[model samples]
Target: MVNKAWRIIPRPLLETVLNNHAQHHRVPQPLILHGPRGVGKTTLILERLLGEWNKGPHLTGYIDFAESIEDHHPQFNKSFPWASWSNCPPPALSSCRSKLEHTLESMVEKGVKLGTISSHQIFTTLNKWHGLNTALRRVIQSNNAASKSAVVGKASPSVLWDRAVFALSARCNAQEIDGVLGLSEKWKGLSIEEASYFREAFLALRLAKEVITVQHGWRANAIAHLNRTGGFSRSLAHSCTDWPCLLLELLSQAAEIDHFQPKLVINNIDVLRNATLNDDSSVSASMYHDSLIWRMIALGANERCLPIILVTSDSYYSYQAYLDFGFTDIFISREMFGWTPQEAKMHMVTDYFSPSEWTVIAEVLGPIPRHLFELYALKQSDYYQKVMGDKGSTFEDIVDAYLAYLQITVVNPAMDNALELLKKFAVDARNGKISKDKLRFGAPWRHPPKTDDPTQCMEWAKLQLMDFVQCLVNTEFGDWEETLHSFFALFILLRLAVVGMIS
Candidate 1:
């Protein structure tokens, strides 16, 4: 896919999220970015992640839960498919590192910036294991020349080699057991039999990426040691120890913004809510029971008091999980909404979008930024492009093209029902039953069961109908009296017209 410039039209919701935690300079808990699906929640955070990668001194551990990666996130090319979700749960070292590798790649782009180290991981004994990413030679050759120019005076491969060993010597914080909390046995898994030259080898791989990303033809002999065993993961799982420490110093030493700097950003966290652990019959439910996200909250996220943001689509926000985990205090909920009239008008003034088309879109699709983006993408597409350039430029003309794009672009089973409803509305609008004052989206169901005397089943059905109507009236159209009166009048008019036609 071709790259598009990320033009994030700022809204009140966007400003609130960007500043909410940063103001305190300490994230007492994760900032929960909550919103309806496809409302540009992912796009908003990703803007801050990649577009502003170096602007903020944050070390993000982004985990996308969708089993497979989509084009929604910024593309780093073919070297990144492995960085997508692997079968491991978030708590698993491999799972977390997949996300951290994203962070690693971003760091490579900006050139690794490290602050003074106050904390380090130490292991009494280190062992040898075979795990390194192969195919570095080809990857390095493919990166652009400008990328090479960016790392003019950055660390040499040899110095990075030493830093890798230092990271390993600090034990990279694998759960070690001092035997006090009964973690002694658990700690041994990380300490015993580590790859002998794993640190050197892994740094060689990273240095290779840096060279490819920023130094061009600067080759390293260490690249030969890179292989595709468990090598990539084994080295990566060790860095989780360094990330929080590395982040702490970076955040601490940074120039204060809102008098504090944020250290982390967690994206697409539905994996923490969904993935299964081991051979458990229940998948998401089980993962939800002992969440790594919750564990992180209880540990450094809360204790260190660093500003952090956790973003997820409302489709997977799961309020039940929130209640189950008692996460009331772990996150400050920020619910995103559609653009206001002024914001929508403001966005239209930009160079990329035309005011005439957007004014109609806001009226039709209700100022949803995501829908606007989708419509923009549709118009830019080759199939729709010809019509845009060659056809009439009227509002109706644009609406017609939008309808055609909608029909084919997002084809789904649910749209059949929606389209049928739309047909009924079109008939009503044509008959003058719908006006600006009473814009009914879908007509009420016409048929009712014939009954002289009410049976128990009929009574039950009546109660169900009232409940459903109440929900619709309350949520869909807010004016209770006017909404019901208008609907009742429209129904009576329809019934009278039907009898007159029969006569």
Candidate 2:
């Protein structure tokens, strides 16, 4: 794992755009960072922007949906291995979707408490407001006495949710009372609005606590199904949606009292679009669920005056959420298609490589930052340098070595079915079904026409090559015309035509 920092080529211009909106007194429209995959959307948001924002009076919450999905199933990297190579059903797809809203709530809670107070303090205050925790006072005091050093640790939102839920449930059970609702009589001095806010926020946190607690159960069920049946099950139940409004409203009110700007950065929202593709329902219906989420968040952003920044590598823009969610009217879009050739050359000139060496490497890898950064690691390896020794110019050998590496790491990992598709397309090219002009132009793979059939759509949604086609589509030849000029593509295509590849 290369440090992503080495791969980052700073874009001060984009940072200024982000800062302009972030620093605004009034809530600016939601900011969207859009690009194809591997063009550094997450790195820029996490490393460059949020780091600086967190150090200021601004409170920030960041979540990468893709990372969360992958976290639940370690067997699948970002490559989404099951969809590419296995017959087993994708694990934790439902779990990830079920937890989405609550996960956002957790992030909101994180922002609200950022740098201002500890989670213990907030929970204590919240308990006082709800007036249901007289039984826990001794327990809290004893715990505090038992672990003076440990008190500073484990104050994350999920932990806070878990503790709050436990205290409330135990108190309610012992008294044979309803949950938060039964505590209405305790709202002695509070105004009606204040009482309502406390009640709703507590209920929302309780529901979020349940969703977080059940995640492990979902994973266990997924693994059990995979072991016994050799297939995946998406039978996990979903959480209710009303909790997000309560969560957001509470966060907004807290920010007003604290007098700090709050920003939320959500990365890889396209995972929602991808997860929904596995749904058994119609595509439109699947999209409708995600659409509702957009409307909720968009409206919340306005009402709460909470600035939100969205980062996605979804090239199709999740079927244009801008138009469908009316985001065009309320969002500012920033596109990162990697750097220009001249910009790459300038950025590549550093301590790692000389002028000529870096120039050749940049030209070979194009403007793609990931590949260029990879070369830094390759150059540092003694074994790699030994392999390339005195064969040719360092440039030529390095380029050849990098291409060979890609063949093994990228092209070779494609599922047998995906390789067959590529070979069949190649044969069609040889037989004139695919014209030379079309091949030269790098035309999109013509998938089967979408019908009303769910089975057909499911078949179409399985990406046979995992990240292989995605890498090309997103990073190198965003337009196929560039494919002909990309030596990398030509090299991979030539290698895949061999019968040994499919076998």
Candidate 3:
């Protein structure tokens, strides 16, 4: 049997180092694996952990939102998580938002119904990550006036608060929740008192979300409808403020009910930052709720819930960002997942590259894993053929012969306009060849956003895009036919979108 298509490089030491640190209940610390792009940040740091995290007692869930944008790029909000997760719901936004918040509060109050959001939605599936004593400590602190004042808020007579504590009691021990409040005759309750600090900061962060806004009834008299029949809806409509963040919070605490241990691996913590792009306040408010949920989990992760591993590339690592956003100090520097020059050398050696060739390429590319990988992908004449493949070119010639051949000869853009600076700089920022081509192609981008000759620009764009597709499908460079098929389908889709827009 032969298996060649699917594989990954083994980096067991890095994985072991991360697991050992995160799983340590005695002294857990978050690790940071930050490095420049092309240094194997994605492959080694992210992919390696993803490949082997399941072998342990914990289950991992990843959410990646990077490597989709590049260099000073401006992104449209039409993308998936970017769009749906960040955009506000239509029309009666206020009513929908109120209902959403009320729904969550109700879930916290009366136990979330089994078939509803608490038990059936994403949060339910994620309930295996138990938060033993995390919620209970909050209830304990909320109960004692001295502790409550010292920690978060004044002792307020709120029914929702009591209900929240009762709900917490179901997950944690019904009796132990009471016992933690009292210390044994021999031992002092110093640890419990100190631990209230964790609960306080988390609760303080969440206090805004729990604001009690009581609306007056429309009854003429007290007896109009004395008894309130039932409670809020269990499952909520998709229309709500901070829906994604709330969903994340609910998922994070889902396992808290029964004290099940599950690891949640949310990738690309950086992408959430984009929510602020549209309306900073709304996004910030939602993130506060998310932070509160993580804060609770983080405060008690060592002695309680399973490790919630958050992944991101070095470009947007959340280590400093977490602190900058006023999050509780829960993460420790887990590990720096980057290859050394020796490791890069080993990668080249493993790929069957000769020392003499790799040495020269390595010196030129400067030990970047991605750069090395791209160079190794093409065989002999791969280096020079790309450099001066078809010209009176010298090694000293300053030109991207590799990209030029790969573009025109291998993977060309529109036939004639391939060299046109406008289309070249369309998707990317003005850099290197793009800047030079601008002088040659004559800054067409300088035209108004709605150009005077829209049809010409449109035609040129269509031709360039199709030419790009042709190169992609060309087997000479790589077998990208299936990918090209998908691209063509997307082209048809874009056409339909354009038609719809016109209509």
Q: Best-fitting candidate, measured by TM-score?
A: 2
What would the per-residue lDDT of candidate 1 be over residues 22-52, giving only the tens digit for each residue? 5554555657776544556666766644345
Worst 10 residues of 1 by lDDT: 121-130
Between candidates 2 and 3, which one is better according to lDDT? Answer: 2
lDDT of 3 at 54: 42
Clashing residue pairs, candidate 2? 89-232
Across 1-503, the per-residue lDDT of candidate 2 in tens digits comes to 12234545578998888888776523635677876444566667767888777655566767555554543333364442212112123223454444555555655545432323233434543443232332233233333454334434546444544454454444434232223244445557567675444443444355434443443333454444443554423232122222343344445545543356666677655554455333322222134345435544555565544667777655445236667666465567788767777787777665556787766765566666656666777777775658657566455686788778766755455444454554454455545675555444332543332243544433433432433455555654444454334232233333332111221
lDDT of 3 by residue, 371-391 (tens): 445444444334555655757
Shift in Å, residue 50, candidate 1: 5.8
Candidates, ranked, TM-score: 2, 1, 3
Alpha-carbon runs more than 4 Å astray in model 3: 1-7, 21-32, 45-47, 55-57, 67-260, 276-281, 284-305, 314-319, 322-330, 335-337, 380-503
* Candidate 2 stretches greater than 4 Å from native: 1-8, 24-28, 69-91, 97-239, 276-292, 297-305, 326-330, 390-393, 411-503
What is candidate 3's CA lDDT for residue 213?
Answer: 12
- Which pairs clash in the backbone of model 3? 30-332, 30-333, 30-334, 31-333, 31-334, 32-334, 61-265, 63-267, 127-254, 127-255
